[model samples]
Target: MNYNLKYYKFGLAIMAVILTFLSCKDKVKNKVSNEEAAISTFTNPLKVEFGDPFVLDNGDGTFYMYGTGQVENGFATYSSNDLVNWKFEGRIYEGNIEASWTQKNFWAPEVYKFGAKYFLFFSADDKDNPNDELENFKIGVAVSDSPKGPFKDLTDQPLFDPGYPIIDANVFKDDDGKFYLYYSRVCYKHPVESEISQWAKEEGLYDEIEESWVYGVELAADFKSVIGEPQLLLRPPLEMNDRNAEWESRSVTSGEVNRRWTEGSFTFKHNGTYYMMYSANHYAGPNYAVGYATSNSPLGKYQKADNNPVLQKNIDKGGDVTGTGHNMVLSLNGGKKMYTMYHGRTKAMGENRVVFIDKMNIEEDGTLIVDGPTTESIPKPLEN
Candidate 1:
């Protein structure tokens, strides 16, 4: 073959191969883009009637969710590899355990993995308490070797009772290897005669009603007991200037200003700043919403975020979702992204709460944003 002719043939062949590779790369890129577009959004109410939902990733490629209801005997959990679809894992905690202290009102179960063991922190009625039946709700701890657990009580009795009706316990482990417990202290008979209360009384609602406040305390290393006095982390705002007062005062609409609530505390630390996300107002009420406060310390003198009610009802926008509260945040994609898992009410279902998961973002200024209480579909959590 002539030298020039052979070189020309080689050049032609190389060009053909390069063109083919570019064509294939374009096809693959289009396929990925289309797949992402198709998954742009997921509908709200991820599951029917899963209230006070808490999601835990056990590093086993499965996310376990525990919440209120579905088991008369104890608490039930659901599992998902992806945030959208879930599989019922059946009852995790058996209220009928021979030595169980409480047999009823098992609510708001949060699971955490410490070392090789898993801990389930929750609230339930203290059957041994001889006080007014309505004030018997207390916090409890259970343990198991697996994430999907038949968790057994750490003790035969409720965790330390703060001499009040307490519920909605959430535990946080700080960077310093310290553990803290956050819970709601029910205000069954808390009184109010302030300006807000006077306005409520004029509205013809009850002058004195109940409220709930979120409290935090350091935990003993064993995680079975409290290490120090509980610190009042959040309470219903009494004055308008109270950063959270407007959203936290849902009770005032019914003339129960003093009965406002600030509960369901979940804390997350970012960039050395602590953010305590909490729910305010009655869980079943339309005004129930999620808000947060930030501090330099885990056990905080935290201040409410100026843009309060980070997540709440969007009904005014022609959405049917309401009573969105009791949220737990999950870090996904190796902490590249975050999500808020919470419960919301569907218009068709009235006060019955269902679990929903939506994207979350933290601003450069450390402001936490929950991209939800969303009634519209949203993208599922990205996988690793």
Candidate 2:
């Protein structure tokens, strides 16, 4: 053997092995760096997928999320310490049990803490649809001792029915120790004549259009019944010439659907004014968006804000976000700062609705503003 040639070949083999080791080390470093970047920031269309997203700060430094269609025959919840990182807590409420009045199609679950108990208010299909209504959704209450719960139905039947299909239950307690429940009446089979309907017919789009409206009523102290009849608070405008009519009628005007929605109602009292923020347009369509009205009382002759549709799709502005509606407010910093928690869709994200927490503020004049439906890296929600 030529010993000199053999020694040269051995040297080359050693160098090649060293190069491969360095390459792997660099790759590992890059992977760690990317993970760190993701952990350090938050973004819109948050990782949690659910429609009608609601976030509740449980007073223990943890936030809980509940929404529609997250689980079968019930609602699923996600918990987060910083609102950016989330852990699935599984289905917290299950319906359609033995002798349970709820059968299926559960949607829009809202939880509240009263005294020592946590109450979950949600909508589901009731068993007593004598005529077989297409969406016989009714609001029901479930209770548990803990926020992360095995919540059980408070009654065999729903809390109460207003003789129609309803969904999206929201309960609010005023400072004076009185409680209120707000919900949306389903638009199924309830067509109302409007200028938009006339326009639709005049344009030969559809013969009629259906619309959902928001209603609010006082809740009994025991959380078992309503103190009075629900009063209509908001709905789609009647006149096509109305300023809000254009944006609110996008679902019909765009010819994507023949329905108008004023559902997903969230209300809060600020500086003596009752502000009701609601979603308009079909929930499943890209035209879905948010708007608000102001009234002196929880149940109101509310006036639609001039600057309505405060948060909506940004596709026209070169962003991929759409279907931005069904919002609930998360109050922090002793109610001085508010975050609007809602859901949206993106071109890249496809049809799945994802949670979005965006900074919202009430201007000095009480104009409500929601800062997003953003896809870019944003400051984490916990950050001041």
Candidate 3:
């Protein structure tokens, strides 16, 4: 039977099986290594000048980010899967003279998925009233079938002008299936004789400065109309409380008199509590910063978080980061982790701003934490 010959053949078969198994294992290991490498190396100032950045996840593993730009006709967007690499999606809304009341000053567009449609809320100057001297900015809504949208205006006018200027519209949907809109009521024509203005004038800080305030209101199901009176959410602190007065007062220090801003409101619910984040000071100045408030309900008698200015420029650390504000928060890894997307200026770039995403955490005491305004590279969000 040639027993030695049979044993030799058996040995060759066993060696072949082991070699095949090793080859498969190497392939799998290399594939995983490549994926990890791709996911970990995201740089800051994400490749685009996205002022007042708003990022929306379509529940389809894709993210679309919108912000202020010089799109003479409409608004634009950028899309990404990994949140690190972005591709421009072009102008998603071009003003229709026949259907739109506004023709210029388009800024800060944010999109949300509602029912079977995606709604885009944005700010622009109303062109309807020629005699109006302010040329006031107002928020309006448009709709599309896809997240990457060429949205059509839902109506021919602004969503319900509060008899004054309003801008930076943000929409939030609560667990009870109700929708709310948060926005900035700009202080353009408001009396400069107010207490804050007087204090500034007396200090020689600068005069004729009015402050922007954050406001919120419930929206009808169609999102085309406001359901109730607007509720004031936040305003710049007139008195310096802790470090808030110093941080939020950067505009005054930077020579932008009467320019305390509390605009760009974004809302998210975590652990049954509602968090509202808003930006302060002039957007173009280095003093721009972000702060938050908390309440039990969406339309809150919300109180400002004592740990105010949760995100701001880190100039004391001595890097090229400044003017950090106008942030949007997104839940990642099935709501286990969160990230804040915002805009900031680098020393090399001056007033020019670029988009950034950084880790956001909630503390045990319900204080919201933003681990950045960082200039260093960071890891991308977990893939769905």
Candidate 4:
């Protein structure tokens, strides 16, 4: 079974509400207190089979979301006024072939708004190059007038593809407006060691295993080209040292995931620290889960979260809720509350990763607490 992240292209802030309700001055109100309301009104919101879920606040009341799609066309977008409900928009753009090495398989399309125009960054492969391995993996740019877009390919050729099998391209801009792209890929194009080849021959070994280290390159002032060499940012110590012995020789390949470490990187700032969540274990098994790391700067040495995995299958139910990672955290209504949006698999749904939203709470120490896919519902809070 082949493990891959499908490409959906182009993908929140909080608000404060002062809600008023009509009442008779003499009547007693059976109002739930804020803490009581929070405990009583929680409901599971998002549901869909997509990865790299990106939520973009349109600056209006509505939010737009985009993720990996089913076709060669770029990513698809969805919109909703309330965080819980969504409406499907269509594919905004498709990759325009610019080089011989780029082919189909668009993965992880991320969109950023720069001034008056919107920019989409996506990964694709070249089908034409036979000898140039560098032409095989690439990232390209597309432009659009709006977030819900009819995005047009901006370059006549791929903006840049290092000629490797690159997947999961994510675009990030610093507070100063510096732009960077992060992704995961194999360590080497060709293997020289017999052990490495034998490992590849294993029933569920990786052709190219994903790692944790992130790479970064400067974006041109126009956001069109890479200004310099891609710099290495992070790599998993477990894989780098070949000490993944605890996980090695496990024969639990029921679905499609092979080997794993680092894939699908997302960044968010919380209480002054930058947090990144990465997936661990094979996506096909119950071991598949999310692990986290944190740093003060976007590019740097990241400290891993506490030993426990952040999200995982309901180990109580034996692969019932497996494959629950590749997620993003969103703030609702100007920091009133926090929510985590991610994907999960259920026995009822078979082997597909569908989106899920759960309200997130912070510990006194400021760490993010993301529990599992819960079905318990609560009453809606009456805002003040």
Candidate 5:
């Protein structure tokens, strides 16, 4: 073969590849409009109805929000360029379809852009209730090629059930390239002998009380399974005298229900301190609220913040917002600003969960604070 002829053919092939790359880049630019209509401010109960709202800030300057109650037996997504306006993206993951392993009561869908693909971690009941248990909730994973997804489950099974119901899956990737799966074990069948339980029985509200606890485990590289046993990360205090216990047991003490929740956990590291933010109390009730704990490691002996219930219903303080929990932190503009994406209820719209985005920050003393559950119009999330 002539050397000149071979070199000419190689050069032609390289030019074809470059042209294809530029063509695709142009298409990407046209795909997202990037919110030409600027928004200087936004109000609470963002026009989108979502319980347990999770916002994913894709590196390409667009954000996608996913949550519960937006779809039936599955999940839906909303896309946004500015944090103020959102466009419904329709159902991304639907369970209960033929051969689907998960079914009704879908909740808390958190998506992450891992490598070239987006992965969604969510929870729902088992489609096949082989045991016929009352609550058969479990965590499941789905994958998509885009942030606005047609995400399909990776397998026809729940992601490694811990012999009980679990929900509110949050996947975290550490600096070491290891993945960690954090979730809340359901209150179902998890009865414990605690002051709250005894008080519930004494008050004749219920014979026994169940409490949800949060757990964390190292996820396998492929995300197909767990690397080891789940470690108990956080749970409601067994002692009523505990500081956080008071806020956490409002459901039982208020005589609304007979359960305590330590669910809706969102963990992230800020300034070398691993902060795990979690919710407590019944999610559908007024007492549902958020708190945080800090640890030196991803999974460890965590200490709850002195400012317990950092974000709670302002009703007691003469405001309308309630049911503010299941929070996922949104880091925008390359982490220059941070906000909490959670669900809440207004006095006029009781029991109907809606989304709330509020600023959160760390104090000089390292206290994690969520200045949220606000009702009035607030300055929109900082895009820069």
Candidate 6:
């Protein structure tokens, strides 16, 4: 055989081998991409009636969710691996106590896992003396051995002392792993001639005149009790008033100025800023809405979002959404996806509120913008 001819044949063989390897690599890449898309795209399997999301990542590709699960006077639990599709995990705790303080009306239940135990925090009022237990109205926690737990009362008594009227308990651990509990409390005074004053005499809101303020308590190393006083973090705007339009009964407040006060205190840090989202207006009324404030620190001197409320609607004006507020924020797939869970009433005569989850995004200024929830199914996180 001619040496030049043999060398040319060998070079051609090398080129063919290189082309084959490149083609195989491209096929593998395409396969992996398709697999990822399949995993990320998921169907919304959650059928919770109202929103007050309780989401936890259980590490094994499984995430647990507890959506407005109030079981027999105590909050319930539900689990999910994907952002969508949930399984009822059963009631985690039983509520009992005759303080004439935390009697009923179980509000928001926020849970956190600290070390080997699960701490469940929630709000309630014994309609007989709501404001009397101001500090007790704040947050309470129960501990359990497992994520899906029969959490037992840690203190065997109220975890917080009743001094300020607080509700909507949210527990967060910072990047450095320090534990803190954030919540909303009424810090403003009720109008002397308002119904609240009249109700105060009979029991309900207003045992004392105080406005709603969001505060953060530094938790002990065990994530149990407060180390110091819950710092005065955010206060409701001094100028808040019933901004309800005239057409809508002054008898029924609406619009912007109607004594807007913060209720739900949900905190999340993004882009080095702490954002607190809260609820306003009468929880049982159609005017219920959500607003947010931002600050540079978790324990903050929060500045109200220049835009005020990030979510609201005028169902009184012939709209679909009504009474949407009291929300919790959750992150999925290790922060690739964010969601807003909250509760809203669907009918005029009904207080049977239901929970809804919607996709949300953060603006450049550290404010959140939510798309709101719909009956239509949405894609899941890891499965998308």
Top candidate (lDDT)? 2
Better of 1 and 5 by TM-score: 5
The positional error of residue 121 in candidate 3, measured at the CA in angstroms, is 0.4
TM-score of each: 0.87, 0.90, 0.87, 0.73, 0.88, 0.72
Better of 5 and 6 by TM-score: 5
Q: How high a TM-score does candidate 1 get?
A: 0.87
Cα lDDT tens digits, model 2, 1-384, are: 699999999999999999999999999999999887777777777888899888878888998888987689988889998987889999888888886789999898998888789999999999888998778999999999988888998878888889889999999899899999999998898899998999999998988999998999999887788988999889899998898999999999889888999999999999999999999998898899999999988788899999988999999999999999999998888987889999999887799998898999999998998888878887777776
lDDT (CA) per prediction: 0.83, 0.89, 0.83, 0.62, 0.87, 0.64
Which 10 consecutive residues of model 4 have the lowest summed lDDT? 9-18
The candidate scoring highest on TM-score is 2
**Which regions in candidate 6 have their CA more than 4 angstroms from the true location?**
1-46, 67-70, 97-103, 125-138, 186-210, 240-252, 255-260, 314-319, 347-350
Which ten residues in a row are the worst by lDDT in model 1?
250-259
lDDT of 3: 0.83
Residue 262 in candidate 3, Cα distance off native in Å: 0.7
- Any idea what lDDT model 6 has? 0.64
> How well is each residue in 314-347 modelled by candidate 1, as lDDT tens digits?
9878888888889999987767899998998887
Please give the lDDT score for candidate 2: 0.89
* Candidate closer to the true structure by lDDT (higher is better), 2 or 4: 2
**Of the pair 1 and 4, which is ahead by lDDT?**
1
Candidates 2 and 4 compared: the better one by TM-score is: 2
Q: Model 4: per-residue lDDT, tens digit, 1-384?
A: 122222222110111111222343223343445556664465543565576677777777777777776445467888887656678877787553442233566766777777788887777765556685652656777789998788777765667765455666676677777776666664334332334234545745555443334565667767667877776664544332244323321222332343334666777667877777766556445566766777777665677666436676674754356667667777767877777777777776677667777666667686767766664564432222
lDDT of 6 by residue, 48-158 (tens): 554566676666776666545557677677776555666777787666554323456566776676567777787765344544553345456777888788777676545
Instruction: Return whichever of 2 and 6 wins on lDDT.
Output: 2
